[model samples]
Target chain A: MSPMPTESAIAEKRQQILQGAMEIFLHQGYEGTSMDRVATAAGVSKITIYKHFADKEGLFTALIEQIAEQRFNRVLGGIYLEKEPEEVLRHIATQILQLIASDEQYVAFFRLIMGESGRFPELAQLFVRALPQRAWKVLGNYFATHPKLDIANPEATARIFTGTVISYAITQYILHGEQIAPMPSDVLIENLVHLIVNQSSS
Target chain B: MSPMPTESAIAEKRQQILQGAMEIFLHQGYEGTSMDRVATAAGVSKITIYKHFADKEGLFTALIEQIAEQRFNRVLGGIYLEKEPEEVLRHIATQILQLIASDEQYVAFFRLIMGESGRFPELAQLFVRALPQRAWKVLGNYFATHPKLDIANPEATARIFTGTVISYAITQYILHGEQIAPMPSDVLIENLVHLIVNQSSS
Candidate 1:
C-alpha cells in the first residue's frame, strides 16, 4: 500500500497546484484553461488536484481567495487605525499603484477577469466579494472610528477613494494611458491624498 | 445601367451599415464580428459597405467616431461655459452617470473594447482619442477660462473630476456593484461634486 502524505506535504502540494492554476488561468483565460492543463502544468496527477480542489470552479475560487489574501497582506497588512492616517493612506496608495502599474501578473489577471466576467458573471461576483467589498468594509470601519477626520459618510468616502485609485490603474494599465499623456503615478496619488485629507481639514 | 446613388441615399445607406455594425460588434465583440455579418445585418451587399468604409478597420473607426459624436451631442451639446459652474458640473455628472448606467449599447461597447483591446490595442487608442481626450480638453479649457473659480492645475483637476465619475460608473455597472452594497448614483455624484466644488471654495 502507498504511504499517506504528511500534512506539510499536502499543504505544499496545494500551494503548487494553486500557483500553477493561476499561471494557466492568467495566460489562457478561464474558459480556455482546463483541469488537464492545470495538472500538466503543476506536474501533479489530476487525482491529486481533485483531492485538493473539488473541480475547476472550486480551484478558480480558491485562486481568487489566495490572490485577495496575498494582496491584502502585501498592501494593508499590519495597517490599522492606530497608524498615522496620512502615512497609512500613502502607503496603501503607493502599493496599489505599484501593483496596478508594475505587476505583470496582476494586470494579466485583471484582463483575464474583465474579459471572461461577461460570459461567466459569477466570476465577477466572486472577485467583487473577494477584494473590493472586503477592503471597503475594513477601510470604511477605520474611517468611521476616526472622528478627527470628520468623514461624513465613511462607506461612500471609502468607495470613492479606492474607486479613484482603481480608476487610475485601469486607465493607466488597461486603457493605454501611456500612449496618451501618461500621468505620473506619484502625481495621481498625491492629488488623491491631498483632495481627501484637505477636504477634512477645511 | 444603374444610375449613381444620390448623396442622401448614400448617407442613409452609410447610416444603415453603421447601425448594423454597432449591433453586431456589441453582441459578438470585435474579433468575432465580420464584414459579411455586417452586410447581412444591414441588408446591404458587401460592396455597399466597402463603398462607405474602406475596410473592417475603417468601419470600426467610423463606428467609434459616430458613437463619440452621438454621445457628445446627447450629453454636452447644449452645455457651455456661460452656465453656472455648479449647474454645468452637475449636468455633466448626471449625463455621464445616465450614459454609463442606462445605456445598454454603450455598456456592451465598453465591454467589447475592454475585452478586445488587449489583443487589439489600437482600439484603445482609438477610443481614447474619440471621447475622453476630447472631453477633457473642452472641460479643461472651460475651467481655465473661468477666472472666478481659482482653479489650480485645470488639466489635472478636470481629469480627476471626470475620472471619479467614470470610476463610479465602471464600479457600479461593469464591476457588479449590485452584488455588493450598492450605492445610489446620486450619492456618488453629489459627493464628488461637493468634494471638487468645496475644495476650490475652501
Candidate 2:
C-alpha cells in the first residue's frame, strides 16, 4: 500500500502474505499450494512475495512458525510458573485442550503438515521446534524449579502432562474419536490435574 | 497366480492385492493413487482388482481396517485379560509403543489418513473405528471390570493411559520431537505405568 517500505510496513505486508498463505495452504494443502496463488490471495505480485520469503518452503516454514508462536504465546504467555503445580498445570491443560479443540484451521493445518511430513520433514521439524518444544521448556522449567512439585524428570513429566491433552485432541479431532472414545474434555482435564496433584503429594 | 479361483486362492489374491495397494497407497498417497497403478503393482488386471474391491475408497478402507486389525490382534490377542493390572497394562503399553515405533509404514499410514481427513472425513472415521475406538473399548472394559484398580472413571482413565503413550509417539515420531523434547522410550513407558499403578493403589 505504501511506496516506501518502512520496517513496520514491511512487517505488516509479511503478516498479510502469511494470512493469505494460511488460507491457501489449509484449503489446498502443502503439496497443492503455489506461490503464484499465494500472491493473488495476498494482493501482491509474485516478485513481491519472493522479496519477503526465500521460496515456497521458506514461506510455509514462516507460516508454521508464526502460527505456532501465536498459539504458544496465547496459551503459555500468562501462566505464573511460580504458582502451585495443580493450578499452573491445570491452566496449561485447559488452555491447550480448549485452544486446539476450538481451532479447526489449526487442526487442519496440523493434519496438512503431518500429511506432508513424509515429503517435507523439515516443515514438521519447524512445527515441533516452534510449539510443542517451546511449551516443553516453559513447563519443564516450572516443574524442575517448583519446590512443592519436586519432580525427578521435569521434561518427561511435562511431556506426560501435554501428551495426554494432545493425544486427546488427536483422538477426538484428528482421528474423529468423539463418537467412539467419547470422554468429556473436562473429565480428562480434571483427572490429569488430579493425577499430578496426587503424585506430588504422596 | 491360480487358474481357477478356489476359495483359498481368492483369499490369497485378495491378500496379494492389499499388499500391493499398501505399497502404492503409502508411496503415492490416497489422492495420487489410481486404480491402474494398483493393478500394475498387484500383478492383476483392473477388472480383477475391481472384483476384489468395489472402488478405490473401498480398497483404501479395507487397507486401513487390515492394518489396524493386524496390529490390534497382535498386541491384544495374547494378553491374558485375567492377568494383574500392572502386568497387563504394562504389556499393552510396551506392545503398542514398540509395535508402532518399529513400523514406519503404520506411522506413515496414520499420517496419510490424518492428512487426508479434511478431504475424506470418512477415511478418518474408518480409522477411528478400526484402531483407537476398538483399543478404547478393550482397555476401558478392563479398567471397569478389574476389581483391583477401582478406577473412578474407567473410560477417562483409559484415555489417559493410552493418550499419554500415543502423544508420546506423536511427538517422537510424527512431529519429530526427539531433537526438541527428547526422552527414552523406556522412561516414558515406565513412568506411565508407574503413574497408573500409583493412582489405582492410592
Candidate 3:
C-alpha cells in the first residue's frame, strides 16, 4: 500500500489469515490444503500471507500453535492449585471432553493430524509438544506439589487421568461411537474423577 | 480341463490372500490398495482372489474378520469364570496393552481404520463391531454375572476399563509418546486394576 499499515492493522490481518488457514486445514487436511487456497480463503494477497508465514508448513505450524493456545485457555486456563483437586480435575476432564468430543473442528483437526502424521511426523511432533506433553507437565507438577493427595506417582497419575479422558473422546467422537452406542460425557467424567481421587486418597 | 482345487488348497489360497491383503492394507491404506496389488502381493492370480472374495470390499472385510478373530483369541482367549476377577482383569489388560502398544501391524491397522474412517465409515463401523463392541459385550456380561465384584454399571465400567487401556496404547504408540516421555505398561495396569477392583468392592 501507499501508506504503512498500523501495528493493530497488521495484527488484525495476521489473525484473519490464521483463521482462514485453520478453516481450510481442518476441511482439506494438511496434504490437500495449499498456500494459494489459504490466500484465497483469507482474501489476502500472497505477499501478505508470506509476510506472516514463510510457507505452508510454517502456516500450518502457526495454525496449530494458535489452536493450542486457544485450547489451553479454554481447557487448562481455569485449573489452579488454589482449587480442590477434585474440582480442578473435574474441570479439566469436562473441558477436555467438551473440546474433543463435541467440537467438530477439534475432532477433524485431530483426524487430520493422525492421518497426516505418518507423512508429516513433524506436525505430529509439534502437536504433541504443544498439547498433551504440556498438559501432562502441568498436571504432573500439580500432583507432585500436593503430597497430601498421596499419589504413588504423579507422572503416572497424570498420564492415566489424561489418557482416560482422551481415550473416551477418541472412541466416542472419532471412532464412530455414535453409531455403536454413545457413553454420556458425564458418566465418563464421573468415573474418571472417582477413580483418580479414590486411588490417590487411599 | 484344469484339475479341481482341493479343500486344503482352497484354504491355503484364502489364507495367503488374506495375509497379503493385510500387509498391503496396512502399508497402502484402503484407498491406496488395489485388488491387483493384493493379487501380486499374494502371489495368486486375480481370478483366484475374486473366487475367494466378492470384491475389494469383501477381501478387506474378510481380512478384518480374520484379524479380529486372531486378536480375540490372543487377548481374550484366557478369560474364565473360575479365575479371580483380579487375575482376569489383569490378564485382559496386559494382553490389550501388549497387542496395541508393541504390535506394529496392529497399530498400523488401527491408523488405517482411523484415517479412512471419515471417507469410508463402513469400515469404522465394521471395526467397532468386530472388536470394541464385542469386547464390551463379553466383558459386560462377565461383570454382570459376577455380583461379587458389585459393579454398579457393568456396561459403563467395561467401557471405562477398555477405554483406559486403548487410550493409553494410542497415546504411547500412535500419538508420538515416544517423542514425549514413555510410561511403562505395568504401572498403568497396576493403577487401573487397583482402581476398578477397589471401587467395585467398596
Q: Pick the candidate with the highest DockQ.
A: 2
Top-lDDT candidate index: 2
User: Per-residue lDDT for A1-202 in model 1, tens only?
Assistant: 9889798988999999998898887766666678898998998999999889988888987887677567656555655556677766777878888867787778777776666566556666767776778778888887788755767777777877787777778767876867685777777666666666667434
Instruction: Give residue B167's error in model 3 in angstroms.
Output: 1.5
Cα lDDT for residue A111, candidate 1: 71
Candidate ranking (DockQ, best to worst): 2, 3, 1
Model 1, C-alpha of A164: deviation from truth (Å): 1.8
A64-139: candidate 2 lDDT, tens digit per residue: 7787677667767776766677777777788777877898887887788788777777778887887778878888
Residues B64-139, model 3: lDDT tens digits: 7677667766666666657888888888888888777678788777776776666666667777777888888898
- Calculate DockQ per candidate and list them: 0.40, 0.58, 0.41
Per-model chain B TM-scores are 0.83, 0.83, 0.83
**Superior by TM-score: candidate 1 or candidate 3:** 1
Off by over 4 Å in 2: A1-14, A34-36, A45-55, A200-202, B1-14, B32-39, B44-58, B200-202
Please give, as one word, the docking class of candidate 1.
acceptable
lDDT of 2 by residue, B154-173 (tens): 78778888888888887788
Cα lDDT listed for each candidate: 0.75, 0.80, 0.77
How displaced is residue B104 in candidate 3, in Å?
0.8
In the order shown, the candidates' Cα RMSDs to the true structure are 4.2, 3.6, 4.2
